[model samples]
Target: MPELPDVEGFRQVLLTCRGRRSVTDVDVRDAGVLRGVSEERLRKELEGRRLGKAWRHGKWLFVPTGDGPTLVFHFGMTGSLRCCDQEEPIEAHDRIVLTLGGERLLCYRDQRKLQGVRLADSADVDRILEGLGPDALAVDRDEFLELLSGRRGAVKSALMDQSVVAGLGNLLCDEILWRARVAPRTSTRSLSEKTLRRIHAAMGRVLATSVRDGCVPPRRSWLTGRRDDSEPVCPRCGTSMRSTRIAGRRTVWCPHCQN
Candidate 1:
């Protein structure tokens, strides 16, 4: 699954590969990856327009064109943007391709096609983003505390709620809880002020590290780094790690480190 860190990495790819480049052609090999736009319209609206700027909000990536519309992308499970030469063979799963100057091609490839692309104007972007809460990476300590204080569900569940804080997925929610020494199933309303503060701090720290590394790297000292072992053990205390579903996603935590 592409989380905040993964989307941030994609934003970098877009900036480097397609920014300011003129779209010479828009080819939609699989229209299933498009929403509210047809193949002909996609080509008509996007082709020949210059990619003006690219920005990411939560899990969404927006690539705007000077011609008045922005290309929106959401990678549901296995979507990514790739840059390759025109001479290179088209990938089997490539759904959308934008041919650019210098023989460069920007491809939107997704195996599952769970989420796809859209064309939006500035007005449309505002409407789509109106319901989302402050980004997990951008929320302040006070805002995070206030948001967490009102939730009655498990801390892990609250963390994964997009309305509470956007951009945190299952892995990030569990990892942050483990780092903050809070159990995954702990009730959000039962948390103390100090614990909430620690959780907020940990969220920022983890996001920064993951974005810097271009992924949520599981280090030997980190629970994520060790959670996939045949017999995973807590890095801090040798106790076996636990795994279960919380908020409908596989959750991992160290019993010794958390709770």
Candidate 2:
């Protein structure tokens, strides 16, 4: 699944391809990738509008067109945004293509088509984002602690919950808990303030590097680097790692280190 870092990278693609440039054409190669808006409406709303600054919150990317509607993207599992040459052949998964000033093509490509695109006005944007909690990258330590304090499930579940702290997915939650030395099954309500603070700090450091790299880089020193090993071991302590399901997703941790 495309997470916050991947979505942030897509925002950069939007800015680099279309910032300040007017959309000369809109092609809906697959209308099934659109939400609520018709193909004709999408083309009508965006054709001659200048794209403003693009922003990202959690895994969602938003592109505003000055006074026109904002284009919202939620890259579910196999979705991505690509900037390619207009002369290049469209891939099999290119669902929508937007021509920027007749120079380049911005493609919305997805294999699964789980979540696609939406066109929203200012009010619609607000309503769409109202259900999400504060973005994981923007929440302060105190606010992070407060947000987890009210949760009643495992700490991993709380971190992965979009309603509790938007943006964290399965890989991120496991990595954060490992760095904080917190077990995956640890209850959020039983956590101490100091522990919560540690988790918050780990999240900051992880997100900073991940956002810069545009993915959860599988570094040898990081848990992600070893999680897929035939028999994964902790990079720090060399203890054999364990895996189980939590929040209906595969969860991995080092029993010795996290204990």
Candidate 3:
């Protein structure tokens, strides 16, 4: 799953490759990766428009064009964007291609063909994003603390809920919990003010680190580094790591360190 860090890296890809380039051709190899807009409409709307600045909110990437259209992309489970020359051999899964400025080609690739792309006018984009809570990277301490007040769900579930804080996925959820010394299953209401404050601080630190690294780097020091081991040991402590499902998503936590 491409999370906040990965999508932030993709935003950089757009910055380096597509910004200021005029779309000369639009090719939809697999229309399944498109939502709400048809292939014909996509081609008509995108071609000839110059890609302006790009932005990201959580896992969604927004590329605005000069013509007032925003190209919205949700990289469901296995989707990514790349920039290459048109002469480069296209991968089999590259679903959409935007030829830019007669030199560069931007490709939207996905293996599972899950959540794909959409085009929205400014107003439509606002409506689409209306229900999402404050972005994890953008929320202030007071807002974060207020959001967690009175919640009964496990802290991990609360953190991963997009409505609670956008952009936190399973890995981020576990990492933040582990850093805050909060067990993954600890109920939100059980958390004291001091502990909740720690969690908020940890969230900001971890998110800043991940974004700086361009992804949640799986370094030996990070919990992500050991999450997939068949018999994983905690990187912070010597105890064996545990794996379970929380909120229907696979979760990894260090039993000794998190609690």
Deviation of model 1 at 102, angstroms = 5.5
Best by lDDT: 2
State residue 167's C-alpha deviation in candidate 2, in Å.
Answer: 1.1
Q: Could you give candidate 1's per-residue lDDT for residues 1-259 as a string of tens digits? A: 6899998998998888845789898889999999998999989988788887788888889988886689999998889888888999998899999898747999999999999999998898998788677888899999998888778889999888777788998778877888888999999999999999999999999999999987788898888888788888888888899999888888888877888
Q: What is the per-residue lDDT of model 2 for residues 136-222, given as tens digits with 9 covering 90 to 100?
A: 999999999888887778999999888888899888888999999999899898899999999999999999999999888899899
10 residues in a row with least lDDT, candidate 1: 12-21
lDDT of 1: 0.87
Among all windows of 10 consecutive residues in model 3, the one with the lowest summed lDDT is: 124-133
- Model 3 accuracy (lDDT, Cα): 0.88
What do the candidate models score in CA lDDT, each in turn?
A: 0.87, 0.91, 0.88
lDDT of 3 by residue, 195-217 (tens): 99999998899889999987777
Error of 1 at 88 (Å): 2.8
Position 62, candidate 3: lDDT: 92
